[model samples]
Target: MIISSIGLSGYYVNRLVQNSEEIVKDNYRTLLYIEQMQEDLDEIIFNINNKNKTLEALQDYESVLKKQEANITENGEATLTEQLRVGYTKIKAHLEESNADANLIFKDIYSTKKYLNKIFNLNQIAVKDRNERAKKAADDAVLYSSLFALTAILVTLFYIFKIPEYLVKPIKGISKQFQEISERNYNVSLDESRNDEFKEMALSFNKMTKRLQKFEQSNLAQLMIERNRLNAVVEQFDIPILGFSEKNQILFANDRMLEVLQVKKENIIGKNINEIVSNNDLLNLLLNQENSNNERQLLRIIVENKERLFSKRIMTTDTEISNSDSLAHDSIIILDDVTDFIQKDVRKTQFMATLSHELKTPVAAIEMSTDLLTSIKVGKLNDEQKEYVDKINDQTRHIRRMINEVLDLSKIESGIIDFELENTEVNLLIEEALQTVQPFLKNKNIRISTEIQEQLPIVKVDNHKVLWTINNFLTNAIRYTPDKGKIDLSASLKDGEIHIEVTDHGQGIDKENQKRIFEKYVRLNKNEKGGTGLGLAISKEFIEAMDGKIGVHSEIGKGSTFWIKLKTNITS
Candidate 1:
């Protein structure tokens, strides 16, 4: 600041000096020219009638006056100098003629001298005025420079003293308190008198410390109560629960878990899970450090000589080692016993068989009745009578179909569905599916096209179930498609699999309904004449059971393309 002030003040001083020197030098030169002009006038007076000497002196005098006129410094000096030039011109007029009257010449010279004297005095006053202004400017420059220096000094000294006290000391106090907080010490204070941001911060810090102190004082008992409550709640859960540290130590074992272990919950706490569980495979799987939080798998544990299925739900916490006081456990292991579910599934399958047998007798009787009515064994029936018989037969068949579908659903869920796999030619399977659905297509006037890739590899699948799935897709396509619409059946060897696609230009399913279309009993727009919505679900089951994939690509108002891909038999 001092240096800058000095530089700026020196800049003003230098500008003033330059301007003042120019004015003073010009004024001095003008004065010298005026004095010389006066001397030349006197010489010219003596040299009158000496034509050469008189003319030379007259020229030199004119030159000096012109020079002095150009250098006029003050406001009034210009007029005074111009009047002197007029007087000199009068004198020159006389000298140029060389036959000039003495009185007229002397009068002109006297007039010239008076004007010159006036001009000189004006310039001298201007010089004095300008010199005083320069001095004043110099004094003002010094005063301002001193003032700026003093202000800078005061600011520097204030910062030097006040920074350490008001800024640095408070900051240091806060920092030291924070350091103490890092060491788990919350008993610290800071100055709170200063009205600044730091004061607010200090107050906040002190409040935080007070809160932390209060928390530290009361935290343990409250935490113990909450922990006990949480433990009790978890213990009351029917499902087993366990918590493990990163070191695989059992931090918590609930009552259900203790029952599974055949030990007291308190006895298992703090013991490693490896020490409690005898199965090394299951223990190693749960204690595997590489297991990520998203990982979950089925595990079996033997209790009282019987094996129980547990869904090993492993959950990892976002606990950082740097935060030693974090409340989060390393990992939480929730063991949900799915043994009852498995048994129930078996019971469900057995119930399906029982229900199917009971319904089969009634269904068979109705079917037999419909057959006899349609036949001529009962009586010769007219056209309307035969139509009623046929309708009754269709209704009976539909009921039977629904019952069969229900059984199939149960069987699929219970994993009891049998599949006869074989290496079947792709084109033959597609041909049989198309042939079965041809009569339905003719009813709607829907055209069929095929694009079977030549020399396609044979796939290993259940031919009946797989063909039934294909026929299901084609039937749906034929039913929903408008009359005269075209359906294309294409089979190809793609990505090392035999892909069969049934594409048709029909009123496509909406996006929201497409995902759930394959689920059990989910139908889109019941207004359309479609089956019980179990066809696609059964189709998905059959295709998946044969290790094939089934899906549909559809857009509303465009069309739908249903596709299936079956794995080809890998040749050794």
Candidate 2:
């Protein structure tokens, strides 16, 4: 644009100069030639009319007219100069022919002079026209030149400053972005305002930053997913699990832990564990502040003034596992409730020990006294006295049986029962049980059906103990079963274990009472000739002591099936 403006200004300046030259060379010269002709005409007329027709003056007048003719350069100047030349020629001829006719010569001179005046006036008009044209051209030159100079200066300054700025701005931005990237700032972005390769470079850099941002977000999302999964699992669990950091900051707690602590999960989470550790010795011990390898059991924690027993296991973060899983916790404190089991065990032990030690001698003395009274060796008894003695003896024996059952239960629960485990045939134990309950079987008129498997696998068990548990089951079946009802006894192998089941067609225990049936002195039906309820309880302990599982499958209004499962591993 600037170059074009300069070229245009130069064209306008040349035009102005050419117009000025036309006014000077054409109009001015024509006017000067006309003035010289007018002066010489007056001299020629003066000499001719005075009758002093000097040849020099007449020749000078002719010479001036010829010069005026020659000076006819512009348009219309030639016509006027030609008219003046013709009139001058006629006057000069008249002057030469009749110099004595002054009036006639003066008339020719006056006509020639009128032509000269016409030429001079025409040149004057021509000069005005050329001058006006020159002024317009001059105006055009001034406008164009000013525009050219202004445009050139502005363009030069723009290139000197703005061009470098355009280059350095993006360079600085890209350099600063590189610095930011080195500092791990992935959010820097450049403005892609220009339609240049620089725009593409900015876009590529933006894409790179976007990819970095996406990768970072994806990793963060994965970690959040893992953490949320762990939280969901712990939230739904019933076991009390409390996880904390090394700084004693509680990371999280399960629903059960929150309930046991009587605090909300929101209340405890992110708080220091020391907030809840006030007067909580069990937590302190289980946390292993003493750093002992020993485990803590029977940790009694009181909630709402009600004490609960728990066996706690503390787990610390494994560096190898934590390194593999970034969301792994620092430490976990897990608690298992053992309140009922421990309480029942302690009460049963104390009661049975007291009963066994305190009642054994008195029961024996009562039995001996009743026997002696019945023998009639100390005194002669009447029939009524003898009958009472027999009843007393029966009661004493029943009491002794109940005491023995309690003692056996206490020993079984305490894990103090002497178990002489050996590879024994389960069929033999079933036969022995049948033989032992034969009197009760006959008295109740209950027929025992045996479905012992052929070539039955030998089971590792305490032989006598197994037989005793089987006999207790048979006795209970015989007692609960109606007269003439059939009882089915079967032995089968299941999952590498021997299952001995005794099914009786008797009143079944209810579902609610089934769980408590094996508990001490817990008889579902008191009216059904139950033996102090300790028989089944003691039998359960005995079977369990021999590494066997015993349970009764019963539903209300349905017959009961009692089963004992023992592991089968035969070794001679």
Candidate 3:
């Protein structure tokens, strides 16, 4: 558009310039020559009496007239010039006569001046016509240049508004497709019909999306197969297993879990567990395990018209899904069936109770019989008989103590032991326990020391049970300590709890055996002990029943510090 405007303006300007040059060269020169001829005609008429000067003026006029004749540019110009020439020749002939005729010469002079006037008027008219034509050409140049410029501007504005829309529309579509792909949706395809770079880009993008879709399908198939195999394996287990996503959505539930939940698989899988937990009490309890006090507490569930015990186990894992950099937390809740173990434990407790009860009577009778035989009123015996009676009494007393321990353990297991909770002073409790174990301490020749903290808080516990646990700790200390070994008993207020500790310098229990010392039938040193392995175990149960904690810290060759922490009366 700009080039066309420039070309159009240039053509019109060239025409106007040519028209001006023609006015200056042709019409202007003709007018100038006509003015010179008019001057010469006047001179010839004024100086007709002087022949030389008149002839000189006539020659100048004739020379100008000839130039005007050759330079005729307008219509009728040549005819006017020929008339002027003829008129001038007549005037010259009349002027050169022997007897000069002034009247005839003057007549020719007037006619030539008339002819010069006509030529001058014609050239002047031609100059005016050429000027008007040049003005029109200039107007046409301006009008056409402006038209072409306006057209160029309109075309430029059209492209300025429309080009971006044409370019950005497809790019916007492709960008939207990319966004969809980021969200794992590969269903979008761009228009490839465009005949540009965008078309090649679209084709390549479409090919990539197709490959990703196919790869995703293949991976999904493999994942589904693996998932099915895993589910099958989980279902084969006797334990109930349930799985959940980070959003509490149930991902999978084994057949055993579904059976225990008493719901169909379709009802729970892929659904939010929170939604199902509202109507299911057992499920609600299970889900609340994350915040429950006793996470490993056995659940007594009734299944198949019989009571079963299940212990819960929760396992969490971080999993990465395809096309994602973040991790998704998954939880697996497994319920292990311990019904048989619990039933067997109950049966064992029953057996121990019965056996201990039956053995208690025979053991008591023999202890009484030995006491009687040792009495002065019953009989006097030799050293050998005395030694024999003393051995029997000692053996019976140990058997009686073992039986009593067994009986206490059985009662504790059955939850039959009645607790007499009372606020007891720490000093008084330690003193009483020391008195009870004084005979053992004396027999073993063990030294005893007490370090009771002043102003210790009283503990709320079963006084007899606490005393018995302390006595057990003291007896064990005396048994383990060598002859003349020192035993330290201490009580203090610690962290709102009354800490009663017994430190014995003896063949100390090893680190490995310290943990199991409080478990039933776990005798740390088989060759050193003479009583049943139920003392520490019974002590643990007794202290725990009173809402206290018991533990031992020991090292080889050093002493063991057996301690129990009971909450103070105020704290309790």
Candidate 4:
């Protein structure tokens, strides 16, 4: 079939070359005839010495030009129209100017002849080049045919002489071996020492077949053992474990996965993960990661039909050793049921909010009562009454502070706190925060000092959160400092981070209590002083939300220095 196809193509190619050569020859012949006639007319006009002789020669040349024009038209040259127009114009001008005058006629006719010679030369050169190309094409076709014929003969001999023993015999033997293996017969083997490479290949092939049989038996046994172990693991654990393909096909589903969906493994395996999860949007996210630039993904996906929430974490691993690209591989997705934990968290947050609100009312009432008792206009009071009233006002203020702290905690836990992020100068924010607490400093009689870095780069952060964090540190510092003790507030940019520190001369926090101070209700002592245990905790949350961190260093009876670290760049 291949040889016949090649021969047919070669025949067409040879025919096309012959046709092209004939066309070139016809074009060259017509161009040469026109040139020769033009030259003859020019010679007759240029040699004219009398009016009658020039007219006789012009008439004769005009007849030859007419015949050449007809030939050009018949040859299909696009230049024929231009040549005829020029020739006719020259003839008409010669007839009018000459008045049968031979010299003028000769000038016009000679100019026309020169143009004709130029055209003839161009035609001769073009025709010669085309003829050479045709000759080369013909020679190439003959060479290609010879090579094609020789290749066909070689291919025919190769197949006729060796196909029976090398290809046909081996194929038949392999088929017989497959039949025997199916019948559980292992004694059958292909001979190896037949003095041919085909026999050697068959022997190697038989060895591979036996090894594959053993491997299949071993693999099946191991797979069964693994399936049992997987079932046991799923039975003991409440979380679901699943395996899915890039096409969203489920390869396996553990006991937990089947139980959650209220379906048997047989019903789910080989089914679409989207149909099992009952969510299209989440299914797309999971499947797209199989070809993603990133290798792992953890996301919260809600199952639409089951009305269940899952925290799915997926990772991909390559199974083929010969892929051109590294990313074409299968992925394993682990679906953990987070529905209960999510519900519990929601309840905890709601209780915190409700408790915070309930605490606010009593705190407000106490503040109102303290205001009435302290005001002389409400009722007159003696020295003892005045002191008691002053104490009551102070304690009420502390209660109000604690209530605000609780409210802040609730906001942090529920993610309701508004973080107004923008470009803020670290130095300016720290200065403003220090001023806000300046009034509280008057009662303590502490000397406050600051060391702000010069030309500090601006940071993208929530100004309010940054100030709040600084204020928390300041409050902690002032509360612990004794009367007239020195407190220092400083800021600096270091190692691509902004550091804000507040140091005091008060008794410092114990080492044991310092670590847990960020936790809610983590006061070292209930009666240590006024203020809620939530201030430090709120500070931590505010700083973290702004993508910063807050911590402290202290020694008992010496002082405590609380510091906050913020990144200079704003990124999620």
Q: Indicate which candidate wins on lDDT.
A: 3
Candidate 4 stretches with Cα past 4 Å from truth are: 1-219, 232-238, 244-251, 255-306, 313-333, 378-380, 419-446, 454-465, 479-485, 492-499, 504-533, 543-561, 564-572
Clashing pairs in model 1, backbone N/Cα/C closer than 3 A: none
- Arrange candidates by TM-score, highest first: which order? 3, 1, 4, 2
Residue 219 lDDT, candidate 2, scale 0-100: 81
Prediction 4 global C-alpha lDDT: 0.72
Better of 2 and 4 by TM-score: 4
**Lowest lDDT 10-residue stretch of candidate 2:** 319-328
Q: How accurate is candidate 2 locally (lDDT)?
A: 0.78
> Residue 92: error of model 1 in Å?
99
lDDT by residue for model 3 over 1-572, one digit each (tens)? Answer: 58777787888688777869756677788888888788888888788789998989989988988898789887887887899889878977876778789888888888778878887888787788777888787887888788878888998899888978987887788888999998889988988888877888988999999999998899899989998987888888878999998999998898888888999999998899889999899999887856466457799998888899998888899988766799999999999999999999999999989998999888888988888888899889889999999889888888888888898988988989889888778788888888777778777788888999998876788888888888888888887889988999998887788888999988788877887889998887778648788888999998888889999989888989999999875652
Better of 3 and 4 by TM-score: 3
**Off by more than 4 A, model 3:** 1-173, 193-197, 290-295, 318-328, 569-572
Per-residue lDDT over 1-572 for candidate 4, one digit per residue giving the tens place of the 0 to 100 score: 65786778678777878787777775666686666567657556565555455456666666766655665523334464356557656765666563546665556666666657665666677777777887788777767877877898898898888856766766787788878877756556777767765676777867977887787689779878986786676567666666766776776767765654557878777888778566444445654555355433345443445567776666676655333454446666667667788889878878877886898888788778877877777888888988987888777677766767777887888788888789888878977887888888899788789888897878888887677778888877877788888899888887788888999987788998888988887888787866667888888888888788789899998888899888975332
Model 2, residue pairs in steric clash: none
136 Cα displacement, candidate 3 (Å): 70
TM-score of 1: 0.55
Error of 4 at 313 (Å): 4.8
What is the TM-score of candidate 3?
0.66
What is candidate 1's lDDT per residue for 201-268, written digit by digit as tens? 87787888889988887977886887788787887888877788877687777877767656776666
* Ranked by lDDT, top first: 3, 1, 2, 4
Candidates in order: C-alpha RMSD to true structure: 22.7, 42.0, 34.5, 13.1
